[model samples]
Target: MKRISSFAFIFVTIVPFVGCHTSSQNVLEKKVEVKLEAKNNSNASGLVKISEYANGEIQITGTITGLSANSLHGFHFHENGDCSDNEALKAGGHFNPDKSHTHGKSIASTEYSKQHAGDLGNILSDENGEAKIDIIIKVPSLTLNDENKYSLLNRSLVVHQDKDDEKSAPAGNAGKRILCGVIKS
Candidate 1:
């Protein structure tokens, strides 16, 4: 009887945790892939993996190489999915469906705003021209369906040659779109 009671208690305590874990994984069943643009037609390239979480948060994790060392690069999502243009101008402006002037928040800032959805602040590169990126974005909503404006799918990711000044109209004074990649599920 004592053995049976102990087993019952352990089972009850662990079951809820197991269930919650499974449920969360089920919610994040969607994922997006990003392919960075090459420079000078060389072998320079990078890729990013973005995963959508249960609570509508986005998990963006990537390792980008072939970038300038000890520099700050502007990272953002663009309106169009096209990155074919040499300058990636085909991606158009930022992902500002709301038409708000609220620019990107500083990476260290915790304040929230109705700013452009594509403004993801900046990405810093190490001295070796490499960057290990791991960040989360809590957008209003994200769906795999392209019809949804909040959907990040079919969007473009851009890396600029300069650091994002963090406060500028439209695109944050970040000069030259260097790398471009389309977000696809």
Candidate 2:
């Protein structure tokens, strides 16, 4: 009877742990893909691809054909992910985890806290008027999956014309919002 009681207690305790581990796995495993289209009255359309892995790093790539070869552009993640009509508004304000007003990552004051969550560096075009970019960023919403956690599902992506001031207000005078898209799983 003593041996049987010990076994029962061990099994009960182990079973709950196993269940909890599996459940946590399911919650943490998620793959998100985001596609972007840049369009406006002044320029041609552009394409961008963003992949969110389970490890919390985001990979972003973009290409713009027929644009100025030697021009610089701005990229960032907005607050919302709604890609419906007027994607600009859906993107919300810049991702301000620390509530700072810096624009691009390069110009940020604290390297980590100066720039907003959406503040990516400039996307430069080559002589062929094509811009290709690859970047890795650590985002809270893209990394966390707990129901009580905040996600970037409702956030939007924006491409700007000029370089981000990294200390400017609104949009760093980055011209206009050329392209916009929402992130999703």
Return the top candidate by TM-score: 1
Clashing pairs in 2: 38-179, 77-118, 80-154, 80-155, 80-156, 81-154, 81-155, 103-166
Query: Candidate 2 regions off by >4 Å?
Result: 1-31, 83-87, 98-110, 139-150
Q: Model 1: residues >4 Å from true position, as ranges? A: 1-26, 39-44, 106-112
lDDT of 2 by residue, 17-70 (tens): 999887665223454555666556435456666655665655666666655678
lDDT of 2 at 44: 40
Q: Candidate 1 on 1-185: residue-level lDDT in tens?
A: 99999999999999999999887663675777798986334334678988876676677889888888888988888889998878788888887766754776742244445466777888888999898888877664555545577787878888888888878877899988888898887
Query: How close is every model to the real structure, measured as TM-score?
Result: 0.81, 0.66
Error of 2 at 46 (Å): 3.6
